[model samples]
Target: MFDYIIKNTSLPEVGVKNTIQLLNDACTIPFISRYRKEATGNLDEVQIGEIVKFKEQFETLEKRKATILKALEEQGVLTPELQQKVESAPDQTILEDLYLPYKKSRKTKADTAREQCLEPLAKIIMSQKTNDLESVAHRYIKGDLNSVDDALEGARHIIAEWINERTDVRNNIRYQLERFATITTKVVKKREAEDEAQKFRDYFDWSESLSHIPSHRLLAILRAENESFIRVKIEIDDDRALDKIFQRIIKSNNACSDQIEIAIKDAYKRLLLPSLSNEALQNAKEKADEAAITVFAKNLKQLLLGSPLGEKRVLAIDPGFRTGCKVVCLDAQGQLKHNETIYPHPPKNDSTGAIKKISTLAEAYKIEAIAIGNGTASRETEALIRRIRFKNDIQVFVVSEAGASIYSASKIARDEFPNYDVTVRGAVSIGRRLQDPLAELVKIDAKSIGIGQYQHDVDQTKLKTQLDTVVESCVNAVGVNLNTASKSLLSYVSGIGPKLAENIVNYRDEHGAFSSRTELKNVPRLGDKAFEQGSAFLRIKDAQNPLDDSAVHPESYHIVKSIAKNEGKRVSELIGNSSILKSIDLKVYCTDSTGLPTLQEIVKELEKPGLDIREQAKVFTFNQNIKTINDVQEGQLLPGIVNNITNFGAFVDIGIKESGLIHISNLSDGFVSDVNAHISLHEQVIVKVLEVDIPRKRIQLKLHK
Candidate 1:
């Protein structure tokens, strides 16, 4: 099944062959791609993902052919030639075409003609030898065929059914439709005045070549058609299709040939066109689905790998207007130290009291930074925090609060903090996201993270599979801390699942901290296979052996120990000693099981053991003078952070509740194709306001060069 994937996906043969074995053994993609780099020839998550996807498709194609062959055998219609054809068919479309003639159907003209014993007459006319059409029809007009016209019609019905069932005819017509069809949509007359329909006004009357239509446009048109707001269809020139049909079926242009032409027209109009149209549409949709999923996966990867403000004593705020703002202080390890509420805005504007409380908390906790949720009353809360005269310097960040609410109300959150209310849990999540995005974001569902478009409308199963693969890749890339990581975060690690993760956490709680990577085997249900797949990506700080604190897997400890012994230094001294690592030849330790790729990674790990792959978070502030859209004038430049991205543009949050759009056309001086390729989620940039519409809550902006 993976033969097609290996040849097409550009991965080395041995790598794909070995990786398939690991995948068969239930190892995850992240584990194979990261820990088993030698087995995959250093193929990253994208190639691995493609291989898995194509392998599944190939299996499905094979299964469908099996079912069809079984049905044919049961019907007593299976022959040596037909069985060979069915078994050799490559794709589902062609396989189904082969099965069409044998499929049972409702009563039709062809069935009636066969029952009347006029099949022999139909066969005679199809030979196209005699030009006497009326004479040929007269022979079958005795019994069920009442007259010459009835005989001719019944014969034509058989001819038409024969034409419809020909594999060549259906394939040729489908080729024409796929190459030359145009998709057109128009608003339904009765639904034009509907308020819900107004959202699709731009597609009220739209027409475009199917080949040239973009994914976003196609999905939008499909959504509109599904809602009954528009009538959508695909069309090809009728004469062009007729020319292809005539070339394939008609033999001569005499009187009898006219009857053949009539059958051709009836077959196409009654059967071929509708079937090919549906096939063309299905192909277009699959293309569109793959495109949308690609965009979504890229955006999700960026969000998961966003910058982190590492391990800080911080203050978090989930600000609101009517309800008082929820405030919480977290220690360096993200443990909740204190919680309170302050009314700093609107009706109960306790500015003086809020300022005093904030300053006192900052001094007492030795807060290094402030993480304020980017939500209602956020900007106002930021202003109040800035005004307070703290005894120590603090960096202020506006963290995206997209899925904090969902996490706060989750079962995991309740389990983690049983006594805290949702508000306090929400604030803690905001602070923790700044400290480490990959660790915190994994707790909530990736779909709720606000990065993808039309997520709910795409194939839910495919979406979940793709997103899960991405999350797993990100988690394993940045190794986890065995003692400090949460159950949700640990569950995403290479081989550990929810149940294994719970056991690990329970073991830690019962048996104090893990002092070495070797201790993972002591946990129940974690065998040698689990340890091999996961131990490399699990880091233990201050472990008994220095290699345990690095990404060098336990299986390779002997090799690292050998290098250290050759250098006449302890393993601890070899770690972070670039001078010593530079002199050793890694090729000396290479074996078939431990190739150059694995050895190279080991040397790199020695140089910088247990390093975080992500960058440190930077503090950003919106224009203080422009708190809302009403205060913004055209052409004013302001600082902002990218909040959401789509096919057309990226939305930049400018400190108010609403964000502004930076369309693809305005991203640069030259033409841009994909917005995500140029920028990313949570990226900070400067922009100049293009236009603002308070009525629609829309603001247009262009990037400041």
Candidate 2:
């Protein structure tokens, strides 16, 4: 099905069937090559992910075809030929064409013409080989069509309306417009408008590759257009496009080529061009949406996997003024150890007391790190920490508390800390977030993460749906710890919801800790379907069924036990032995019910049992000496951490609050196609400082030669 779409549709090669299979199987690029070995010939994740997206689009098109067919059939217009056309429609644009006449619309010129009793004349002109357009005009020149010229004009109007009404013509024109259109944005001259769109100043003369324009930029241009501060037009060469369509129509009707030419030109100028241009712009917007979602997903992944300070006790401070500074200490597992308030910044201004209290807590709890919220008087708090000169080894870092307040006021926070004050809860969350970002972050809304670009500008429902999917995929991809996971984390599990997740937690609390994943079924409301979806993803470190600790689904237990028996060992003994497992002939296990594909996966998981699928969270220690951009010099090779890898670039951490951008072009001295090929997530690479802009907080770095 996917192959047929790829061959017939305008979808690129990157969007293919095999690629989607690799992605759907969750086989890592390295694993796919090392294990599957034969399948895919080892295409990497990047390649596979692209293909998967393409396959999804193909499937979407198929669904749309079915919908169009049903709607047309309901209207009694679905002829055999029309049905075939609908089924074979190559893309969404064409599929929409098959539905357009039946599609709901307000009021149209063709409808108006039909209402005015000019349907027959319109139909004759649409046939194109009119015996005489003048004669046809003469026939309709009675009521509304007054004179010969008026009748001819009305006939031209009717023909244009009919041409536009044909779904095929509209679809063709839309495609042509998208292929040839340029998004031309021009400033409305400050004096002409209120200039409320100052953010779009750079876009005043911008003309982007219509297919590749980023969503944020597209939204900005649209906002400018909406506010009337900029006039944005989707310009296409109408004459050239009309000529191409006319060539097709004229070839079909050779005798009326001249009349058809006039009609085609009139259709484009009066009807087709305007409507199709709007459709093309909408197509451009959808393209932008896809790209934006891709970028946002990548960034969200990076943010979710951002280096966790690891499981270490932390002291967090919410720097403040009149109310003083709130201080909270959390243990290695993020449990609140203590809480207090010290007058640090203004009003009370007890800097000495703050320093003494922080140092005492650091020494007493042996706090591994101190997280100071980057809010009001954060710098002053950091300065106070520096002045204390603690005897114990403690690291102090300034953390962004973007959503700390939101979490503080949230019901979840209140539930987590029923006894503590909201401000103290906020401070504790800030501290714990640095320790285990995924765990702490799951407690808060994803939108508050501040990683998205123009997140507010996109369709809120769609944005939420897309972001929620990303979060769910990320959560499931990295199996959750059943004992430690919060309800928010559990809620994200497939087929699980807030109510069920809460029930699971309450059940755990009411009873003892669940020794096995199967026990989840015993929990109220967690039925067979929910268990099937959630069980494979939830991990218990030392469960009764060892398979629960690993990704091996329960349904594959019989196959695993048979393999164990064949090896002359118990199932538990074969859990983590790679040598014995690799020697077993996988062909022996392959059967009709258990195919080679699934059996191979089961064998691999058994060899390295209970492996955490998530990329290991790294602990990064910043070089405090290199606080400012000016502290670094050109040609100085410094050790930096790879923070993210995108198609266009990689962001590297150079011990500063802001990460430096290492564009793909600057990644290496050799030809590099992908940023991932050159660097990976959390990779420690040596980089040379290329340039720094302190004002903009931007740094440019090049990987060391």
Candidate 3:
């Protein structure tokens, strides 16, 4: 079944088996790749990620097929042949075509005419070789069908509508229309005053293949259309379309070829064209959404998996005016050490006091860093901190407080700091976020994280669904610390929710600590399914269960224990034993239900234990010297980090606030199309600067050849 699906679909060959196994085991893609490397040929995180997405899409298509088949079966129209065809349909589009006749719809003209007893005349006209179309019209020439011309017109209309309803005709026309369609976008010059229209001004007279337009450009055009600043219409060649349909009908009969031609043209102009155009538009929209969602997911994953600065003594300041700069100091473990309010900006302003407070706090606590919220007065506050110049060196940096206010008023924030004021909590969160971004950032909603494009414009429900999945994948990829993770973080765990997450936290609070991953079952509402999905992703470092310290699932514990016994050692000693593991007979313990496939996986994980799934690196601090495009020099070699990689190019972080583009052509001395083939995420590389545009903040680079 897995092989058949893989052959039928576009899934990559590298991780297909492991992906199928992961889906069956209910293990997430993150868990499988991070913990089961040997089982998956050591496929990198990205390839496995793609396989996971394909598996989900395949499952969704299967469910859709089942629903369609049942609907047809209940209608008593499901034949064995039809059922086989529907089941074997390759994609949702084909399945929908098979089910079109049975699918429910709103009132249509053909159905109304059939109700009026015009079916015989309509069928005769469709046959087109009857003694005469006039004779057929004579039978239905009554009431609304009065007069020969009226009757013929009604019959022709019915024939046209019937031809339109044919699934084959509709599908063929839709395909042709998509292939031949040109999306034309026009904007009214007068309505371009709105700030929203500025982005679309360059696209006012745009025309492109419906199938080839990029998602971002398509979305921009759609936004312009919605605002009425632009009128977009998809155009196709009518003659080619008419000829295609006419040939199909004409081949059947030569007697009424002209009548059929008229009918075909009418069907296309009135019925097929409009409906298929709408479908084409919808297809374009769906493709755009998928691409946009994929990009959004990738960016979200990177942002979530960003290297944590780790717990450090941090001084947080919410640079402000009316309330003064609210300051809070957190210890290395994020406990509030002290809090103070110093007026620095305006009104009861005292720069001296503010500087004194910050310096004193830095010196006394030996603060390693100061996190200043990037709000109205952040730069001013940073300047003040720089001037104060504490004797004990402290690095001050601006931190984006995009959702700081939202978190401050949130219930989780209140519960975490019941005694502290909202302002102080916000300040502390800002400071802590810089120290450990993944931990503190998880406290806020993923949507509020500021990584998406047109996030507000897209469907909120769909965006949330995709973004939530991304957050879950990222959170699970880097296994969360059971002791330190917040409920917000735990809630993203597969099979866990806000309520269950709270229950886990409360259970831990009441009891001392989670000694092992299996202890989660003790928490109320955490059932077998939740445990199966969430256990592999939650780590209890230095815990009682050695497997918990590693990513090996609880279900595989007995297998590892047996292996350990075979080696004449405890399970603890068996971990990290490559030679001993290779000597074991994996098939000896494999059962009919639990195949060797899963058993082999269990053995491989035991070889390398307690692997930290997250990227291994220290927190990266951008160089102060390279802060803008103007700061970059042509032909200068700069040490940088690869931020993103795509087929066409790579975006690198060169210590400038903005990332630079390294096109694939410039990536190496040899030919290269895929950026990933040469560069990877977080990989540090040296590149010679090629071009720099200060106004656009665009820097182009070529890799060191």
Candidate 4:
């Protein structure tokens, strides 16, 4: 397994071995990446993640090999040569091919022919050494054999099955599929004029090389096929495919060879084409799924790590037209202080009343910022709020309301605010999201947040697994506050799961806030291993020991103390003192187990204890003149925020109902391989409108340099 993983990942053998050992110990990825740097040779989370993926793949391959070997043995055909072939097969394709001939299935044409006593005739024809094939086949005129043609046809069916089972034939055709196959589609004739079919009109008559098709396009084509709007086919050049198979089976031009030729064509169509074509297409789909999942994971990570607004009193409004705007006031710690509703748009153009209510509420709650949900009536709400004069300057921000409704109806939301309805809950979510994105976003489903690409079309299990890993990485990267983090956020910490998180929260409720990291040991069910894994990622502000607030683990406090002792100062004094931190040689503290990587990390943590790696959230305003898509024009420069990214492009929210797309080509004049390399989620940027299709609600944009 180690050799297999090393071969696949091309990582250092020692690092791979140690990482596997740590994984065997059930250590979390974030913990191993951050705390076990010395043992892992300083591999990052991604590299360690690759090791984990390849290790699982190797295990799955071995399990499949074992299953195949057992099946072969049970069939009484487990020859030593066959056993060696199965054991040495590198991948699923080859291993399955080796077992294909012996696999049990529903009675096929070949099975019927074999039942008709045609096995000897097939072997005779396959040798292609006799000119009187029909004469030889006439001997099998027993059961179900009416004439010489029947005997020959039955023997041909057996021969076709044999030709299809050849490992070399399957491999050659698979190569052709992998290289030259084209995925073609045609609109389902009945569904051609339907409304849903129009969405995929571009794919109605589309054809692209399977190998060169983009991931997004392939996923789109597949989705179209799944919806019954299109008929999809995988094809390769027939003559080229047949020629390759014929070269391998045809040894002479005798009557037996002619019979074998007929069987070869039948095999190529009936057995080989369908089986290998589906395999090739499924492989392409899996690759496309992997690519799409990667894009979604990256987008989710960026959205999770978006800039935070810190602790501030906020007034949030979930904008609506006829339903009015749901308003909620939250304190600096994101606790809901007040909730109400105000009609500020259309039917109830009660601007005067709404302004008075907003101003009075802002003053009463001492609101420092306003977060307006960017939904229906969002522009009108922002305009109304901007007109009001407050005693203190309050920054107004338009927050994306994506997935807010999902959270509003969730059980977690009900647990947080039992008395408030979903509207109030949604408003509060918007306000809290501004205060700290990672903490609040973790409460909602990552998929529902609307930052992914082809999320539903990808493999759901793999998508969920990757998204969970991203969430965990983000949560650990920005250490959670021990006393204040919600159960959802706490659950994502290194080794703490939902149950442990709930227990920790319950313990905090029973007894006030924890004072230090050591107090975690007293929590129910939080054993030594959990504490060791999770303690460093949980921060405690104003703790008795300053190191508790920083990322420095408890096990390494002795090393920090040693450094302070050498500097002739207290541990607290050494904390954040750059001159003192810089003067200390990390090499002096390096022991056999504690290397420079660990010591260097400790010093860096001491410099900025419990520091936020994210930037502070800033207020953004869209064009006051452009309220809807109708106002947008070609070549118009506008400010927008990147909301979603894919392999092909980034979608920007340009202060309108419809977001504009900046295709990968428009990202820059130079070639761009990764969308994230050029733009990020939630990044404010200036863009030039390229085109707008009002009917389709689509807009094209180019990044403004």
Candidate 5:
């Protein structure tokens, strides 16, 4: 199974085998990738992730085969040949087709005929050598078999069942479905007049080949069908399906052959077409689900790893329309210092009071930046902030408040701020996000982040797993600050879980701050294994040993000390000194346990200790003159920021409530297969408005040089 899986996966056999062993030994992906590079042959997080995926798939397939074998034995049909076939099945679909012939079901036409002693007649007719089929069927015209036609009908039912059970027939039908299947949808006539159904108007009469339909379209059509707003089906040409089945079953054209023909047609409409069609639909839906999840995972990874502004005192606002804006002042460490509300927009229209409050907060808390929520009245709030004159230079930014409300009402938020309201928690979140995106975003559910396409329709379990993988990768890539990091961020560290994370936080609160990474062992339940796996990715600034603050693992501390002594310098002298680092021989440090890959990363980490892999978050403002969609004119180039990314394109915010879509076709002059290849989340780019539909509230944009 491992060999089979590795053949399809990107990992080599040795790497996959060693990684599987490491995972079986209870190692996390990030831990193995960073710490066990030699054992895994330098496989990164992505390859490790694939190994985990294929491992689960093979386990599931094996488990399914076991159940089928047990059921066949219980049914007294466990022949050596059948058992061998089941045990050696390659995948779930093939295993199922092999099991279909003996599967138990409710009493069908075939079962009735078998109970009436017509099995011999079905057999004779199947041979297609009998000259008198009616005469043969006449003898069976007793109890439940009235006329020759009745007896022959029952025999046909049995023969149809036999044809349906044949592996070749089913496989041929499946092959046809794979090549020529089409998905068609039609609106439910009664539901078409309902207001709720209008959202799916574009899919009311849609038809497309299942082989090439886009994932977004398939998900949308399925959503409509799930809502009972439309009927969707997978189909292929009926003649093609019948012909394929005929080539496998019908062997003659005599009276018995005519009977076989009748059975084949019955087998198709009753047993084959419906089954294969459903299988095709399910297969397509699963493929669509996987594609959607991949897109979502990519978007999430980009969003979570977005640039951070580092430590700065910030004032954040959760903008509102009628209730004014909720504002909070956060210190450099994102600790809330004060909260207040200011009305700069209508109905109160107290611009003077709002401007005075803003200027006062900026000076009072020494706020260096301002973050306003990109929600209702966001543009108005931005305009108001631009007009305010501060004593010192302060940059203003608009942050997406997609999941602010959810996070505000969460238990984590409540625990963080027991005395403050949800609105205050929300405002502080925006400010903190500007300072450290991964730290702040980890506190909210990935589903509510607004970076998904049809997230709810995809498999929730798979989505959660994929999103968690992304978050873990991002958190480990940017080593966590042990002393000041939040519990949410620490939970995503290599070996630390939610319980251990909370324990670490409690210990920090009681002991003040973590002076060294070794102090993690003092925390309850943080054993040796956890420390070994997690310490390399957990940093403590200004620690006693400089290695604790670097990505250098504690297990390798002796190696570094030996080298430092040999060079007649302290270990601290070699840290981040590229001149000295380039002079050291990495090969001399390799051991039976450590190899070149591990030694190489050690050298790189020393060059830049505790480096943040992400770019620096910059202050971006949309076109100052263009404030709304109405102001957008076709062919006018404007500076914009890519806010959300999808497989089809990216949505760019051009100082408007509705972001403009930059379709993939316009991403480049040449063909573009992936949107992320050209654009990224939160990237700054110039775009020209291609089209605007005010009534529908849509904006189309194209990339500009």
Candidate 6:
């Protein structure tokens, strides 16, 4: 396993060994990356995650090898050479190929021929030493075989099966596919006229190198095929494939060689192409799934780690057209103080009454910010709110309404607000999202957050696993407040899962707020292991022990205290004293367990303990001239925020119904390999409209330098 990870990743063998051991010990990724830096050789979460991935892959491969070996032994074919081959198989594909001939299944042509005693005839023809093939085949003409031709055909079937079972033939075909396979599609004639089929029109006549197709395009084509709108075909040069097989199998120039050549062609078509082509396609699909999942995970991480507005009283509005904008006021802690409706749009366009209500509520609640949902009347709502002259300054923000409804209708939302409707809950979510994106966004599904590309078409299980990892990483990266964090947020902490998170919340409700990190031991089922893994990621504000509120683990509190004593100051006085921290030698503090890495991290933490790694959320304004796609034009410069990113491009929400796409080529003057490097989620930038198709509601943009 260590060698496999070392070969696959750039990590050293020792680092891989230690990381696997830590994972085997049930250490969470965030905990190991942050707290056990010394043991992991200062490996970050991603590098440790690579070790975990390769470790699981190696374990899976070993389990598969065991299963194959057991099956071979049961079949009475586990010879020394075969056992060695099976045991030495490095991956699942190779192991499966080794066991293919012995695998039991329903009857096939080859099986019937073998049952008819044609194996001897197959071997006779396969040798290609005899020119009188007809004479040799005549002896097998009995029972199921009525004539010489029938005997010869049955022998050919057996020969084809033998050739298909040869590992070299399959590997050669796989090599051909890996290098030369092309994916092509044609419209399903019957379904081509259907309304739903038009969505995949771009794919009807598409052809691309299977290995080079972008993950999004491949997934889209596969989706089209799944939807019955297109017939997808994976193709390679048949002549080239046959020639390669011929080179390996056709040894002589005779009637026997001719028979073997026929068998090789049959094997190539009937057995080899279908099975291996499908394998190649499956391999491609898995790759596409992995790439798409990576994109989704990155987007989810960025969205979760978006800048926070922090603890501020906020007035939130879930904008609407006719139902009236649902308004809610939240205190600094994101607790709802009041809820109501304001008719600021549509037939009930009582702008005067709406503005007056907003003004009065802002002053009454001491609102520090106004959050307007970027949905149906978002622009009008923002316009209406901006018209108001409040007594105190309030920064106004347009928050994405994606998944707000899902969160509002969730059980978590219902439990928090039993009397309020989904609208009120949704408004409160928007407000809280502005306050802390990581905290509030965790309540909703990551997919529904509208940051993924082809998320639905990818492998759902893989996508979920990766997104969960990202959420966990982000949640732990920004330490959760033990006293005030929601259950959803706490559930993602290092060792605390759903059950323990709920237990902690229940315990907190029963016994007020926690005074120290050690109090986590009192929560039910939060054992020593759980506390050790989780306590560092759970911060306590204004705790009795200052280290409890910082990222310094309780196990390391003595280290910090020792440093403070060496400095001739109290722990509190030493905290945030960067001058003293810089002057201290980290090497002097290194012990058998702790190393220079952990000591350096400790000193860095003492300098700015529990400080947010994210920037403060800032107010952004959209161009007031554009309220709809009709108002947009080519070559118009508009301020936009990057709302989504794909390998091909980044989509920017330009304050209109249609979000403009900045193609990867347009992202930079040189080459752009990664979209995230050029732009990130929710990054505000100026964009120039290069093209706009009003009929399709499509807009093309270029990054304004």
Worst 10 residues of 3 by lDDT: 615-624
Of the candidates numbered 3 and 6, which has the greater TM-score value? 6
Candidate 3 Cα deviation (angstroms), residue 535? 4.0
Q: Which stretches of candidate 2 lie over 4 Å from their true place?
A: 1-80, 87-90, 101-136, 166-175, 190-196, 212-216, 226-228, 245-263, 319-324, 343-351, 374-402, 418-422, 458-465, 542-548, 556-608, 613-705
TM-score of each model, in listed order: 0.96, 0.79, 0.79, 0.99, 0.98, 0.99
lDDT of each: 0.87, 0.72, 0.76, 0.93, 0.89, 0.92
Window of ten residues with lowest summed lDDT in model 2 = 28-37
Q: Write the per-residue lDDT of candidate 3 for residues 285-305, one digit (tens) a residue.
A: 877777666666666666677
- Tell me how candidate 1 scores on lDDT: 0.87
> Could you give candidate 5's per-residue lDDT for residues 91-172 as a string of tens digits?
8889998999878677788999999998999999989898988788889999877799998898999999999888888888
- Output the worst ten-in-a-row residue range by lDDT, candidate 4: 131-140
Q: After the best TM-score superposition of candidate 3, give how far the Cα of residue 313 lies from its true spot, in angstroms.
A: 1.9
For model 4, the superposed segments whose C-alpha errors exceed 4 Å read none
Each candidate: RMSD: 2.0, 5.6, 5.2, 1.1, 1.3, 1.0
Write candidate 1's Cα lDDT for 514-620 as tens digits. 99988899999998888888888898888888888788888889999999999999999899999999889888898888888888888999999988889899888
What are the runs in model 6 whose C-alpha is more than 4 Å off? none
User: For residues 1-705, what per-residue lDDT tens digits would candidate 4 score against the true structure?
Assistant: 888898988999999999999999979999999999999999999999999999988889999999989988888999999999999988878888898988867788989998888888889888889987767877888877989889889889999998899989998999999999999999899999998889999999999999999999999999999999998999999999999988988999999988888999999999999999999989999999999999999988888899988999999999998999999999998999999999988798888999999999999999999999999999999999999999999999999899999999999999999998999999999999999989999999888999777899999999999999999999999999999999999999998999999999999999999999999999999998899899999999999999999999999999989889989999999999999998887888888899989888999999998999999999899989998899999999999999999999999999988999999999999999998999999999999999999999999999999
Candidate 2 RMSD to the real structure:
5.6
> Considering only N, C-alpha and C atoms within 3 Å, which residue pairs clash in candidate 4?
none
lDDT of 4: 0.93
Looking at candidate 6, what is the lDDT of residue 170?
Answer: 95
Ranking by lDDT: 4, 6, 5, 1, 3, 2
